[model samples]
Target: MGVRITYLCVILCTSCNGIGIGIDLARYPIDSPTSDEYLQMVNRARRSLAETGCASFPGFLTAEATAEAASEAAAKSPSAFVTDSTHNAWQLPDDDPARPPDDVRNVRMRTRVASTAYDELDEGGALKRLYQYDEFVQFVGAVTSQPRLYRLADPLGACSINVFRPGWHHAWHFDESEFTTTLSLQQAERGGEFEFTPPLRRSQAELAEPAVARILNERSPYRVSCVVADAGGDATAPPVTTAPFAPGTLQIFAGRYSLHHVKRVADDATRERLVAVMCFATEPGKVNSAEVQQMFWGREIDRLHVSPMSMRANRLVRSVFLMLLMISVATVVTAEEAAAEPVPEAKSEAAGEAAAAEASPAAEASPEPELPPLDCKTHELLEKVDTWSIDCVAMWLANLGFPELRTAFTGNKMDGVALKSLTMEKLAEDYGVSEEDQRKKIYYNLKDVLRKDNAAGNTNHYSQMFFWLLPLLGIYKYLTLRYEKQIEKAMKKYKKWQDARNPPAPVEIKTFDDGTNEWTRGLNRDVNLGPKKTKAEKDEEKKAKKIKTPKAE
Candidate 1:
């Protein structure tokens, strides 16, 4: 009995100090820095990062932890904002006046990916806990040889889940941060591999633009490298059938100088490629710029830049406005209700007869009649807008009191197809409707009509609910103001640290030479690490390519 109990304990209890955080401490004793195992792991990571600008530790998390992280991400992924655009390797805008049309910065590539921000993740979840772990931070600092490392303070970009669904791809671009840390939580069924070049830029002052242009123009064997997880559970320079990391792999990469991107996920993939990006900065209170935050998370950095006093003032103004509006609405409603009286049956009949007698023949014989109620039955045509005619859509809009849209639709000859595809930008640019309130009214009402049309028993009572909820908006603003004030106080308390001048010296990065360098020897080779195709499929492709269209004899 004693022997059996010992065996069971040994089998079940595989971790030591990492139990709470779900780290596999037996294999990676990060808490025990003096241990030989810890030293070896750190040295290997440092060496790999120095050589290849990246190092990955597989099995960093236990199996249960990895699954939990993946599950948490999957739940929050529905809210992830889709970023689809075409830009250069530097993530430049489409039209750049600073660079000529033929410049390498003008070169375009398409990327369609989604990201779930740090604020979206559960605060008590495994991924969040791991990111906040002191041991993990210390380990990353040791690996990078930094004297100190601080987690990014950016609310949205501090930690985020990069989700690559089917047909999504991240274009070749460099990160803005000096280094980036990512944990592999899940893998797609096919494609989606990490590929990067070695340090192309030595420093901010000396950017190797020519070398970048070379890779962008010509993906030569000397410039690009493909790292993949091998069967022996290590990241190596060889083709593999899976993604670069198995679940529970932790990768620290110097992505600022090394251009990298995950390959396009295959259209037929059954699963998404999910990676938890854990960010750290050598300096304290570091956060992503407002532009980066907006691009990735579709929001600013918690609006922390606004002063608390100004925020409080704004809140006070909003509260007063809301109170006045609510009082006015209540007064109007009460007056209308008080002005009306229940008519007796005899008096109602008498008034109807009098009203009929007073109506003139010309008024009764008018060609245009009063519009009917814009009810669900009438708006049902909008549910299948493609099948409806322009006249039908115009009549509906006119009944809804949106004559501007009706005019725009008639002028543009915008049929149901165009009406269904109307966007805010279209309304502002193409049409003359510049007022945001009017545009929102037209747009959201159209959506609401469609929604009610499709729903089984939904009615158009949203406007009533909107007025009732107006008071709650003040409450929301007040709560938000209070939260912001607290955050403001906290931020000010750390003002000294945020303004500290002594920053760590930048790490030295070596640039790779194209001609004189031994390109064939190291990890900087363009090896095919994509999904492996069978020999039969390769032959079929070859035959298809060889059999070109025959020209006319």
Candidate 2:
């Protein structure tokens, strides 16, 4: 029994050693450096990174490992989503003219990138195996001098391989992570150098015009070199440096503090740049938002990964609700016009009596042609309301007897689409309509105007679909605004000329007992009261007018 137990113990020990033997740690040291050698190697790397915000070790991976890793990456490259897109560093506000046409903020970047999510790789792949190694993780912690380091908990973003084909590049952007470590598997034949400006911006306020302009328009002196080494051997010897494209090298960078970009690969280059990236977080369970995931990976990994609502999505929702509101308003206007038509005068009693007295039996038997239903002009004037203006919003609120809310809305330049996103709580918070009843009143009033059903509670899927369609409404609004000014000018001129020629009679103005207008009528009311006049009626009217006019004498 003792002999058998000893053999089993030996077998277990050998299996454990075998499990650890795959990662060749000779080129990449896994053991902590000794005290005497520490200052020359570890301390030097730490100091270089602390001062310059970037450090790299050359020939960290053997040629065979690099070739193997490159093979694995190349095999997966065909599945990467290659996308070309344009974006400015700063998001330009809608119709903001304050930003100069030639401002660096206005510059749009064009880049093509092929990137795959880490979850797509095989479990035993080279990249996955290297990242999962405990010794490798400890070695990284020691080199960076970070007290504790954790592999990213995010499944898709933990490890990724980036492939830069000819003419592909990564545009300048601040990284979301603090530290990024990359292993160069293969280098482009030409022009795919990594360039960066260290300590560019610490916060949004620091991303000022002059600072960005200096980096973009002027030659900056703070550009960091990709390759850096510690001085070794003779004291007088300069630390060897190489371009960032050197394969088999490992690079560690403080990407959060540095604004960096990969230079475009040469248009004629035959080789591709393959890089394996491993991202670490100081804390565990750190994950990126769904928008960032979609932007980088072309698709989200999970359906339940909800991100906090973004302004762009809000804009889309508001735009869609505004479109529905426009349709509702149009329906209300048509109904009001139908109701406002004047009642036609019956034939004069005296004329009817005389005609009866002189008429033949056949004339008396003939019936009068049915008077056509009163012709109501289509109400296109509702489009004139400038939803972005405070006065216009005030006019709308005033109709609801909440004129005091105008002060709250003053200086608000949000368009109609944006206003459609307002909730009762937000309305109460902003306008001091703190009373629950008052808030409910305001919400109901707006709801009646904006929606036909006035359904209370959470929005359904149909409502979500409507919000998605709101961008189409935005496009229509843009096109309409472009022509609205010209139309308003023409209408003003026509009104002036008509007033001058007509010299109107005095008329009594009637006021409603209740402060109610056509809009107060619910959208459920019938809007199609009667058919509009056909072209035949217009032609007959012109002929009758000509016949009634006296001849020139």
Candidate 3:
């Protein structure tokens, strides 16, 4: 009953901590401690390492454990010593002849490493527990195929958290150890890619110049791959065969044989990358050399401290050099100013000439046509963007508040002509802009160039108008086109209704009923409506009308 109660209490304690204290066998699988399943996992990892010089296990740490470790590291980050410097891959001393002075292997490294001494960690801390776990050590040894891999005895260099803030990077360098193990706790917002070239340097005397040049020139032929965590019981996500970075994964690499670097993180990154480096050595009590300790940790162990006499000598040399440099700079500046001063004889001659010119009325009457003030707008439009370079387009977009697209354009070599020919679908595919709103923003920003008018103009009016009225015209055209069809339909309906409301008036007709028979007959012939011409003509007409009436009766 007492044993049962002890087990229950242990379970309760683990539950309170939100995760088990030791390696979660479900993920790491040391269940039988010597089971076939565990050995198979180790063998597979070893095989991958041998084949590719690197192996990764995604989700090696439980979610709860990862979170706790990240939190602890963040809390301790304020005390972390930040080192920013440039060094070659071998990290040789300045006097070492083996170190090449002009080799491409000389690269700059920048990073901030936060170290937690083994003695300082809380007894129940996740990192401490993992480091102390017997199964974890055995598992690492088995996977590395090393006869025995022991924990680093150095108090300061054993286990540490490496923090890479925005714009920071790890330079191209080989590791001091044969194998390195790291767990990625977080990732930067963008551009913290991990890249390496295998078999770059075989020995101090032998260096692969072609491969080194390709990587340094950013044109390496080897494909970069990333390990992705498997979720929902699915198989491991296929390695990102073309991308250089991976986050939230566990990796073990034989870095001594591989030349590797972490690409610089972007300046606009929102989060930094956090990684825990668990160092181990084949032999026990092995510590990093004094030079490497100073290079990476910013200080040397007491036993390896430089002699006071040598330090004083170095300081004296630096002070003398600085003093001499300042004096030389001052001398140069004074000489330049004196040389630039106008000569007295030339000044007097120029003054006499000016007075003679002023005395002449013809010369003084009309001043030379004042040159126009520099037109910055025209100059920028014609001289800058008109060059049609990819860099120029990026600058133009950056000025217009679309700086994020600058990288996309530059990467794809999208010059003015290429930008003009790009379609929305193609832009989305090439740039990875999948969001509807962001896609619209990019489309609208480049629409002017994409749909530019190419008709012959007097002075390249398209570029001029694009720089000046593009914003206003874009707004106006969008609004106008949006309502054009609706407005046309409404106008047609109104015209039909107006025509139905007003109709043409009818024609009028009139008739005369009271008419004499003689008059009617005269009307049928040629009626004479005028007064009688003479008295004889009137008497003749009266006689003719009376006879015609008698005959009718």
lDDT of 2: 0.62
Q: Candidate 3: deviation at residue 204, Å?
A: 7.8
Question: What are the runs in model 3 whose C-alpha is more than 4 Å off?
Answer: 1-19, 31-33, 95-101, 105-123, 199-210, 219-248, 302-553
lDDT of each: 0.71, 0.62, 0.60
Q: What is the lDDT of residue 424 in candidate 3?
A: 60
Instruction: Give per-residue CA lDDT, model 1, range 421-467, as digits (tens).
Output: 78767878998788887777778777665555555323334754664
Return the TM-score for each candidate structure.
0.49, 0.45, 0.45
Return the top candidate by lDDT.
1
Best by TM-score: 1
Error of 1 at 437 (Å): 66
Candidate closer to the true structure by lDDT (higher is better), 1 or 2: 1
Q: Which sequence of candidate numbers ranks them by TM-score, best first?
A: 1, 2, 3
Summing lDDT over every window of 10 consecutive residues in candidate 2, give the lowest-scoring window: 1-10
Instruction: Give me candidate 2's TM-score against the actual structure.
Output: 0.45
- Candidate 1, which ten residues in sequence have the lowest lDDT sum? 1-10
